[model samples]
Target: MAFVEGTGDEFILTCFVCKNPFGLVAQFCGYCQATRQQALGVERARASQQIISDEPEPQPVHNISSEVNTPAAERVKKQKPKRQNLFFQNMRLRLDNFKEWQIKRSKPIGATASALFIAFTYVVIQTYIFVNTAPTLDAEKYLYPAVTHEVSYFDASNSEPATAKTDIFPVKYLKWSASSSDRWTTKASWNGWTGKADITFTPAGNLETDRPVLAQFTAQYSTYWKVFRKITWEPASPAAILKLSYPNDKNLTIYFNGLAAGSISNPAVAAGSYQMYPGPFEIKFYNLNTGRLIDKYTRTYFISTSGVFSPSYQN
Candidate 1:
């Protein structure tokens, strides 16, 4: 017998008649000189038959409806794990896209919100200042007209008006005017003396001294003339007169004891009277049309018996 080396599942076989496998290298058996092709063909047919016989027998097929109705067939059905994984992947992609979008828009959104808040706050503050802090025409009550008084004393013993003992009391709202204008003059008569006076006032003009000058006069005497010779322009009680000498002919508001007393407009003289007391008072001047504060005066004043408190200012 003879053998040969080979690879894989194939091997060179020896010829049975010659007992020689060297015939694989040639076309015939070396010892018996038989044809190798015929022998190889017979061996291949036998191997095929052996292989076919060794295979297991096929089982019979059952009815399709019966197999579907069985529980075991249902358990063998394919599970779609890939579909579940694809669904989760889509959800994750959407979440990532949303995160990227938020990051890109955050700066502009934040800046816009901040700018809006600042603008709103500024508008609110400006409105508050205009409504509350700015001056208004309703506050004109604090510029009321001031008060004034004139007092006179006469003596009957002297013959001439100049030589006669004459005492002129300081009167408020007393102003000087050119000799021609007869616009503001108050005339009154007592038992022994005739009184005539002129007051010139302009809030926007210069202030001039208003001293009383004696003119020609005749004296009349009666039984009660000596006792009743003193004449006063104020009430008999101890009250004080406040006089404001402003140069302009405009509307004014007066404040007494830090409270709004009243208002006055286009007066020849600005004057008012109050009960005689000592207290601190404030006076504020405002422009009637524009609602602006022009000037202010505050003082602690005392009012004695028959005293006049005169505060003067020019525009």
Candidate 2:
């Protein structure tokens, strides 16, 4: 290369490495950008070596393969395997040639599975509702203790507060398979409880017909009024009793298993007509037994047109 004598302008040289336009001329043709960069590096190394002449160094030869190890460059040069969607193509081909029996059978199989699933669900739901809502025999077995429920009040002016004028309670009767004369009863002890009415009766007499037993209390108008609504008279345990209340002395009709037991007649029951003091009535039931009497229930009754309305209300 020769420089012009009068012109001070520098000549722009094309890159020999990649055959691209560059500022200075070089020994290597830079046909590729990476090769041009390598030529520039070699020139810089030569200049640095000339500056440090005291250091021992070997002269480097121009070898294209020794410039840089680029896996991407190797991949660009090498061939790549072609991709194929053979799995999807095969599935579509098989579906086109699928048998009629296989396709039709799938519907019934799906329907059967769905039906079985629905049936299983319904069974589970039904079981849950039955277990939770329905009464269990185990609980009924344990609830056999006799109890007496009482509700009554005495006038502050007339009698003692401890004594009730009338008691209203429910009764249960159990039939015993025996002769007419034989009978069994337990003492009227509370089922370990002071107030509700409950009893367990075992029949010693003939159960073919209703049995009649005497009650120590009398059933009056005022005694039948109160406890008619609040009673749960489930006739499960053999025999139970109801105590009646009264403001005045009166005759009471008694029923044993719906049969007439005995009526109590009194004359002092007439004075309770116009007295507004609690209407005067109480109720209770007792078991007539040889050893001990089982007191089933103790309840207070209120007067109503239909009947007593305390422990239970029945027209």
Candidate 3:
């Protein structure tokens, strides 16, 4: 039955000479089909041939079907032609276009996504630092050790912890008394004026001496050397005593000449040595307890009194 196939939707066309399905839905054999295509070209050339007025007109071929197809070919003439579905064809075109667009845009989309991710990461890191890291200063307690040194005061005020600016006053106003004859009565003092504000001193080293060197002052500033806002001092001798008496609470960092000494928590500091010479100092008074910076003085001075170099620090 396949040998007698027709070119219908359910039937396939077959070659008469080979007696096999041609696989193509056409009337002729494969070899014959090729020959027909070549003949069609020859026929088209012949039909286009025309002569000038002097030449005789060529006769056109009439009934060329008889010349191309023999009587026996009519018996194998196939029926029906295959048609493609319009919707499926359009869908294929759309899929092809979509694939092309994706290939072209993939790189830009990926780069944009990566940039957004990096930006987000930077924002997160900045937020973390803002929340956790603390600056190296607290101003309100710069000279008052009681406010900063007392934990209860900080708790009540709810202040942030601060870094110490080791340099307070440039001069060592409190010096060791060499004229002391009594081992328990020798004294120390300061002579600079603080304009309108009261001055105070905080010792950085040994406050005790060979003589009584009475550890008291005429005024509050005479006890506290606050002339040069930032200062340092060096001792000719190692056991030189320095005394700093803070009437109230404050936070301050004291340095021994050029070396880093330590922090002071006591309001009244006595019994210290040359290490008490707070020199090479810097001051930024930020009150961590109050969460603000106040007492912003910008003057610094160093002076020598009675063969002794002292620092007078100012706001």
CA lDDT, candidate 1, residue 114 = 100
* Model 1 C-alpha lDDT per residue in residues 142-261, reported as the tens digit of each score: 111111221222211122343232233223212223222333222222222332212223222323333222112223223333333322222122233455444353565544444444
Q: Which stretches of candidate 1 lie over 4 Å from their true place?
A: 1-241, 244-247, 266-275, 296-306
Global local distance difference test of model 1:
0.39
Residue 253 lDDT, candidate 3, scale 0-100: 36
**Which of the numbered candidates is closest to the native, going by highest lDDT?**
1
Scored against the true structure, residue 238 in model 3 reaches a CA lDDT of: 23
Instruction: Give the CA lDDT, 0 to 100, for residue 113 in model 3.
Output: 92
Instruction: Report lDDT (Cα) of residue 201, candidate 2.
Output: 29
lDDT of the candidates, in the order given: 0.39, 0.33, 0.33
**Ranked by TM-score, top first:** 1, 2, 3
Poorly placed runs, candidate 3 (over 4 Å): 1-105, 124-128, 136-172, 175-315
RMSD of 2: 23.5
TM-score of 2: 0.20
For model 3, residues 77-151, the per-residue Cα lDDT tens digits are 686887989999999999999989988999998899999999888666544543332111221122122211222
Per-residue lDDT of candidate 2, residues 1-315 (tens digit): 233443222334444234344435433433433333444444433332222223355566867775565466554555587786999889887887676556768988889999999988866654453333322222122222211111211121122233233322222221122212234342221211112223322234333343322111111112212422112222222122232333221234433333333433432222121212111134332333332222333343322111223333221
